[model samples]
Target: MFSTVENYWIKGTPKEQLMDCLTAYKKENLLTLAENQLMPMKKSHTKSKIATALAEQLRHNFKITVDQLTETERHILTAYASGNLPEELTEPQQAAQATLVAIGYVYLFKENQQITPIVPKELAEQLLENESEKDTDNWFLTTKTTVETIYGRCELSHLVTAWNQHASQPITMSEAAKFV
Candidate 1:
């Protein structure tokens, strides 16, 4: 049974699909992935067993799971989650994506002459859900009100951008300056 990841992999819940993709991996590869980077789990046999176990565990602890990835990989995943990443990746983006694949958070799917980076739907859902939990609009509104009280109704697009930069990432002062 040979099939690409984006294909059948059972159009089910994100977790189910992720389990399918992990199951598709050869046993050796899955073993390497589990041991080397993506997760820490009890020893196990059988493809479906390991995948199912990891998926269930990951669903509740996605933030912890993501912490296992590198900073660039986490940034790429977050960028994707926030709907801000470009469709075409740059060199560094490609390298980060390759690392994601190796860590089992992403897959490269080729079809019709294009290679697309595919984060497991399960992981994407979790990441986007976490991002939405930020209550960003409420925070922005509070900041906007405070600024208007002090400055008497100035434009705030720049302020909004500043808030977004500070809120979306945990960057140092210098790194924040670079974005500006």
Candidate 2:
């Protein structure tokens, strides 16, 4: 999932690798989401195609078996590419999810060409649009500057750190901020 990948990236994985893994992961998630959507309608056969496409992409890009991926990785990819969130991700997962959401990586028909704000859609569209560009060949491309920008926002890091701090408790953003 983008959240897990973002968590790893936020913790300091290189952007290129984050983008690489996240891009692959996003596509894979789309396939699974599509499978879920269609399965109950008796169109489950399409999942095979989705899997094949994922395999090829994995082979060409990540250089690993699809089996090596975690459940969050798989689910987030599906949810993101499909422009939705799964009901499952827990609180810590939500912290990563919020980070990704804040960075404007959560919406798509294609990658957004803007660097998101602390609250993502809260900023003026033109301002956000003026700040970045989507790298079409790789939908997940993000810069170190962007990561640094994210870090500069204590509110964001505090939010994640709060989640990290209370990995066991059910805390909302407002409560987490106060505690942090």
Candidate 3:
């Protein structure tokens, strides 16, 4: 997403204008915005009747569903939320990690040749304390609302096209700074 924004700046879009665009984009993509700050990513699945009912209601209202996270994934999410997940993983854990990443329940970042988790600690705590899937769904709603409210104070199709044009190499900071 940063790449998309950078590319826009590269194509004669003013930085201040791009910042405004990003502010608007953030307002529009609440789930993507909350991925880091407001909520832990977890599957929305539950057998509890109340939770099921609530999930249905939430789905209707927010278009978000609670996925039924596997037991292993739940454990991993718990550990990640608590900041206890190890930097190194066993073979099985590695596979589980891959699944979590694929499902968007977790994100991995590469830095200095090392991969790391970008767990939201508070969100993890909420997930760990959730007694039912309804609680989890409620968290999602709260996060969505929060992101919208926070960025409400703040459209990049062309930028994406420009990014595809230069996909072979990263957009340099210097190159990006020109528009600013």
Candidate 4:
């Protein structure tokens, strides 16, 4: 019974808080009523009901049903087994919100790391300057073509042709830069 309750508890809010919210929502129901009017009626299987039904399903499907649990135990077991518990309370309890908030911050930290600032073109240029010959050639060709294309100049084609020729016979950066 303790294991069943603990599993259903979900390591978050107290059962009382959820019960309160469910009770309040059931009473007021102004927004939910309007929304539910548009939505189709759900199958209306409670967690406990579903759990009991699942045991029946297991018996039918697998030809087996465990006999340890009583009717009340079956109801509680079904509810817990389905990993469902009711929100019978009002506004979310502080402890529940705190747990969720902590989870939110973990996600926030990951997002912050992924949101890198755009590296300036000048930085790319500087990085490429000290690289190997092949890297330097690729960088120069890419940078030259990008710059010319963005400026709507027809010189990019000429620059690529010059680069291909220079690759066949090595040339200094100044010499290659002049051709491009």
Candidate 5:
């Protein structure tokens, strides 16, 4: 997750500049600096919280270009901000959505075994205001399938393979009976 944001950060500035920005932010907030670098103390901190704070500070204070998100990611974020994504998603869409969740742009909630996306209030507001000039409806929608079925199929396949691999190694009835 940090890798994704780090890539974006490095693209826009030198490593030293990034570290300096984090250091200044940490000092301004009275937060301890991370070991060997300039990140704030991360104990008990969520990645989304850290990323959002860092990104906001970098953009607002340093005028750093931090949002290097792909067009697909941007659209997914937009839909998430507008609360317009379909309730269910296809495997590929889910994977992409998972990336968004991982990168701190969105969040997920599980209720009654169903997972849903929840966009952060501040992020949604910023995106809406910043992207207002663009035509968001041009974003494409794709078909979706539930994650449970995908996991089920994957587990079934692995079980079948394991069973086939060990099928020839028979255990004696006495050994089986010992466990029983």
Candidate 6:
């Protein structure tokens, strides 16, 4: 994982920066995050509680979700590893990124007027810790079917843009799964 400081992607430690970003999220968004974690949330739960719970939960649960990440979502995180922010992104990419955010696997760091999507360095290490070959038969063909179904015949290069510039950068897992 790239250094958040060296990369200038954050102003503080990843955990602190994550909370800062989480607090900026709407309560509804936080609620989505909690639900995604399978954490029971009360209607009266304060935003702080929700965000804090997610941060803490992520300390233990990042791998489970990472294991299930669609290929494009994994690509999104890999982009951050290399500090290569691209110029364009697609709706399906945005949706997948948003889902990852909501799932607490990704954090959006906003500094000096630019928003850069990041995962905690520790989490990034954990993701690469195993460094196994991509599983080709786990879930359904997430990318092939999802992309072709949504944006017919999109080129591989067009789909590789930075995920940070979409509707919002973060977590989710519905699409953004395919390419050559």
Best by TM-score: 1
Candidate 6 lDDT, tens digit per residue, 1-180?
212222323343334345665776678767766877889988699999988887788868777777788988877776764456556768767666666665676776666766677766667676666343233222224544567789876543344343323434332233334313
Model 1 — TM-score against the truth? 0.57
Per-residue lDDT of model 5, residues 27-47, tens digit only: 313232222125555556754
Q: Rate the local accuracy (lDDT) of all candidates.
A: 0.61, 0.37, 0.41, 0.33, 0.45, 0.61
Candidate 4: 10-residue stretch with minimal lDDT? 101-110
Task: Tell me the TM-score of model 2.
Answer: 0.21
Better of 1 and 2 by lDDT: 1
Clashes of each: 0, 5, 4, 12, 4, 11
Ranking by lDDT: 6, 1, 5, 3, 2, 4
- What is candidate 3's lDDT per residue for 1-180, written digit by digit as tens? 222222112222222221222232222232333342234433342223322332233324221211466666666766775668686777777666655543334445444654456433334444655534444345334544565577752112333334446555444434433322
Candidate 6 similarity to native, TM-score: 0.54
Could you give candidate 1's per-residue lDDT for residues 1-180 as a string of tens digits? 112233322222333257766776666566666764546655567777677766565556667768677777788987765546577777877677666665567655444655545566778888877655445545556666788899898455556466656776543444333332
Q: Which parts of model 1 have CA positions greater than 4 angstroms off?
A: 1-16, 37-44, 65-71, 79-87, 135-180
177 Cα displacement, candidate 3 (Å): 60
- TM-score of every prediction relative to native: 0.57, 0.21, 0.35, 0.16, 0.42, 0.54
| Count of backbone collisions within predicted model 4 | 12
Candidate 2, residues 7-108: lDDT per residue as tens digits? 222222223322333343344454443343232222343444554443344334321322343556434543443336455668756664554342333322
Between prediction 4 and prediction 5, the one with superior lDDT is 5
Candidate 5, residue 83: lDDT: 79
